[model samples]
Target chain A: MDMQPIVRVRKLNAWFGAAHAVKNVSLEVEPHSVTAIIGPSGCGKSTFIRCLNRLHEEVPDARAHGEVFLGDTNIYGEGIDPVVIRRKIGMVFQKPNPFPAASVFDNVAAGLKLAGIRKKALLMERVERSLRHAALWDEVKAKLGSPGMSLSGGQLQRLCIARALAVEPSVLLMDEPTSALDPIATKKIEELIVNLRKEVTIIIVTHNMQQAARISDRTAFLLLGELIEFGATSEIFTVPKEKQTEAYITGKFG
Target chain B: MITFSEIAAQGYTKRKFKNRLMCLLFFVAALVALTPLFSIMGYVFIKGVGSINWSFLTQLPAPVGESGGGMANALVGTCVLIVLASIIGMTSGLATGIYLSEYGRGKLATIIRFSADMLSSVPSIVIGLFVYILIVRPMQSFSALAGGVALGVIMIPTIARSAEELLKLVPASVREAGLALGLPRWKVTIWIVLKGSLSGIITGVMLAIARVAGETAPLLFTALGNRFWSWNLTQPIGSLPVQIFTYSISPFEEWHRQAWAGALVLVLLVFSINLGARFVFRPQISRD
Candidate 1:
């Protein structure tokens, strides 16, 4: 039997006021694999990813017309709460946006707390596990009481990941996770991403082609709000089917 | 070559003269603004320092010409009235500001903002008159409660406008971060937006208090004045501004001297509160 796809996007279109940001995007993400969307800036890579969890619903005059399925259930289906969908599909932003006011422990347990997990021992246990899963446990274990912002940039990004993972989502979405970090921190996060793929389906949007090639199993190239090509990471880099993909990988043009 | 050098020197002298003229204009403007500040301080010190006795601060106002009386009643009453006003003004103002910045958008927020601006510009005497008709007549007496409510009414628009401006200064990215976590909008505002802008909000509240504390017209008809100590909110209370106004207009030498002392005390109190607010709300050094 074929393994089930964790997320499937079909004919997705997103518009920001008068601007059509994403146009006719369709792709399927397999379970337990990293699918990195690669494109130049303003190519709707981020918008496409944001649609996976309906984060764009907050913007005024922002409307998305498409079908996004999360494990055979249409996420945008009627009566499906965006909050509940977000709880199941977590995201990490480009910047390490840990709640600046909250402590490290509270940051990791934020989702659980929102879900009304009030028991101290349960919160502590879940926070520890999530931190361990994000590979941030050893560094932040002793300083869990300290502010989340007190961590190094790379550590803070990982803490954000830990915070997202604490809700135990099936798919983890990362938007340029290590783009803000130094080389060493980027390498650490790349390794963590490789390890995380074993437990959850991972979708990442990144501008760094080399990082996408290194960490992703499949790569999707998007240009001007359209998905130009999708295939195995090696093939997309070495033998792209589309001219736009070749131009992008060889730095000929955005 | 000598003639060329002479021309260059003349050019330099003309430029220097123009620069000096500009500098002199700036200096005059600065000095003109500062003169009243210096004069007030000087006048207060010269007139009131001799009356700054322990008894003057500790004892109630005595008979019209007596030297033993202090502004004790006025001082305590002013503190109570300002505290009550601050509490009412700051809470309601903050809530309204949050509503405007977070939830309000089109016509309703615009109307509220316009009304608040108009309210801030309304004359303080008119505010006093309004309070006199609305609150004092119903209660059938001039009281500290009426005074505080009048001052709070004046302060509300100031505090709300400042708070709204401060809240707007908070970057949208901060709010986005909280919302991205699937937290509700209200939770994000209270737990994140409010915490991030706490210092700016406190500064706005302090500035509003300073503005209301020195107001003389609003309290003229509301609190009126008391000759002795009065704790009843329903009875007349002796705030420093009203006491200064009444005593300064009186012909007695002792009353005039006491007014000067009370004015000095009020100025000092306002100055210290402003300084304390600045110290408390100073930005923290970021580790990054």
Candidate 2:
């Protein structure tokens, strides 16, 4: 374990109304590493990841208990704006949802504009850079003024990633970013994630064990709102410490 | 195999009656809806075409039984009022809708939604009277501004409720995508949610304009009517519906003819606006 982990979760509990979505689970994410949260459906992996940035607050009855720290800063402390936390910790959702009304250029520039960057030349430069980082620049460079909805599903998802990267956040959260993509797009995004880890810390929630083993340095196994195991990706896949993790990896049960 | 003909005969008789009954019911329902539409068109054209002339449209309203007057000023007033009302109604309604759909979920939003629904159900005449008390009497006179404001009041609830419903139709994933990019709440609503629901909002605005344009009661106590051309917002103005209301009641043949012509123009105007909105806002259905 590193002396100063970038993100630390301690005794974290979450509930959606009366249903406990995330149990008292604790974990740490080292700085500048790709940590994959792997679990089957309804195992609270997504909920757990969402709690890091307080994204669950949008749900009417969603509530959380305990603490989350971003580099020693208590994320849930009083007077701390979730908006600021979210800006620091950007997220990409399960599906590709580019702003339908905006042009490709505008979609990439959205976060920058929100941060009050007004110079058009600077915005264009950053948008191009982010698009290139997301591996979408070549195909969309000529048609940056076109509506984002005109892009293919795979392209739109990458555009979303570019939009996320445009704001230059410290931590990037991806919730099944490639689940809706085809094999080729998924491979490209996986490659992008590997490249992105050099510059930004990443927390990815994926169901594909192969993907987690291929890209993540560390992996966390969650089941039914409880953290079953957390360790190096190779150990979690090959020699899990817990029987539940072993059984899950061996296709015994989700 | 043993008695195929007899089985066929039994099945055919049982199904034949039900099929005929269903066809008859469907035919009657279709007729019930189509008859009034066709008859109204027929009646309007038959009576209105006689008065549809350059003079009838360009001249001013004459005395009670006299003929040879135009509805040009009334038509212009109606256009200006409806356009202004639509602008006010759409902007305020869309803002209220975004607040309700995006930022609101608690008691205040619930109350606003409830009031909006209640207001939509209130009679146009009641809205007119309310505007009269609040606006007309306060100003101590009826004016086009008062009329447009009253029409805007009637329009706001309809547009706001429809826009809110449209905004609700947008999937939450779209909002999540914008938020995940660290976009602020207002930016997400304006850039994503509002854009996604733009077509639906336009439809609602157009429908609101159509509803208000045909209303005479609201304008009765507000704009009143002008005998000659008047462009001033602070003075009484002539409009199609109020003109139709006044002309339809007179016993003179010429006034009756002019009323029919005005009604035709009003219907045509509403129909064209609706058609234009549908043409502009309906999503493109590309083959690819």
Candidate 3:
């Protein structure tokens, strides 16, 4: 916990046309740790995480004004390439989207290959290491030539993780990565997230409070596009400082 | 009071009768729709099959009142024109489609989309005249290049519109996935989005080509039809549709028969192109 923060957000505000989505949110993520954002539906949890990688503005009429620092560099600084920032901070979506028509090996190696890396030996090595890190190499090693879409739901999500990890990003942002999964698959993903903490910083957005409490070291609560509470997971669950947080935790209302 | 079993029995009989009636009506409607298509093919086959012999295929057209002749020059000319048209159409059409689907939000894209729709509805004869004024008039003679340009113009709107729709069918998530890998926008579009939609684009291109293959009006003023074999783009050329038109208008009954044969050839060529596109560019739906 003595290392410099991997991601630092300062007074971020985002809007979708005339409607405000994320309002005046600020937080810092420690390196190689898991920070989970929890809230009800439409609380801008997804929007907040998307802003870290500068993907929120991709939507028409959607814009964000903020300063996000990756290590010592502000990602939104003048003349900084959003594409480069995205490579440094990878993302996993709620649905498992493996590039259609691509093989398992190609899916993992796509990032490296598109970046002009042509050496086959290097691509093979990176694809193997990334699949192994995502806990999918054993199940998929024999079927690397198969289409990525042919995998089971859990396996496809893991393949996406492997695809993201192949780029060797410093931070991984996951938006409700396990909501679409069954209990067993969800358990596997939770374990994988915990195991991945030693290699890269992780920020996950989730609606399931139990999932947040189980997999996260620290938790941030958002309500109606505003940050309500931010603290250690144990402290936030057992001793919330805000009344809204206490009500939400005690099953009073969303 | 009626029992439940009695009510169920009554409803079942009524439902069964209704279903059978609807099925019969649908069958009749389908037959009505297919009647014209089948009759045309059957009539053409009966009329043209007798004239399509080896001599008719390999030899040049005979002079008036002669017994037999083949449209060898027209057949080769049609193929050359199609190749030239495809090059022009696919390049411009796909580029326009990519622009419309990927980065088309502003006024320029709107204008381009509107122009494509408008161009698609303009009569082929009009387009022929336009190309004649643009190319043939300047060159001071009808040429195969002008005919190809006319056909290429006719192809662009259909290919562009269908390509845009096909590219749009690719989910936004796929594009986002490519972008998240740090690849530039153009690379993501060309390598990922366009590649995934390739089979559909090929289908669209085939449809456009089929539409222009038998167009005689455009080539009438542009290529002007040639009796002798010619491959030079600067000189007049012969095509199946133009040959058929010229032969059908002649006073000789022999020319009329040969015209029917040319029509048959043109239809077969278009049909085979469609089948070939489906066979070669079929989407890979099977898993390894």
Best by DockQ: 3
Ranking by TM-score: 3, 2, 1
Model 2 interface DockQ = 0.46
Least accurate stretch of 10 residues (summed lDDT) in model 1 chain A?
A94-103
Clashing pairs in 3: none
Candidate 3: tens digits of C-alpha lDDT, residues A85-185? 99999999998878777899999998899899989999999999999889999999999999887899999899999999999999999999998899999
lDDT of 2 by residue, B87-187 (tens): 77877887888888888878999999999999989998998999899889989999888898889988999888888888887778778767766667887
Off by over 4 Å in 2: A1-4, B2-28, B63-67, B106-108, B284-288
Tens digits of per-residue lDDT for model 2, A135-174: 9999999999998878888898899989988988889999
What is the TM-score of model 1 when looking only at chain B?
A: 0.92
The superposed Cα distance between candidate 3 and the true structure at residue A13, in angstroms, equals 1.4
Interface RMSD of each: 2.3, 2.6, 1.9
Q: Given candidate 2, what's the lDDT at residue A151? A: 89
What value does the lDDT take at residue A137 in candidate 1? 99
Please give the lDDT score for candidate 3. Answer: 0.91
RMSD of each: 3.6, 3.2, 2.1
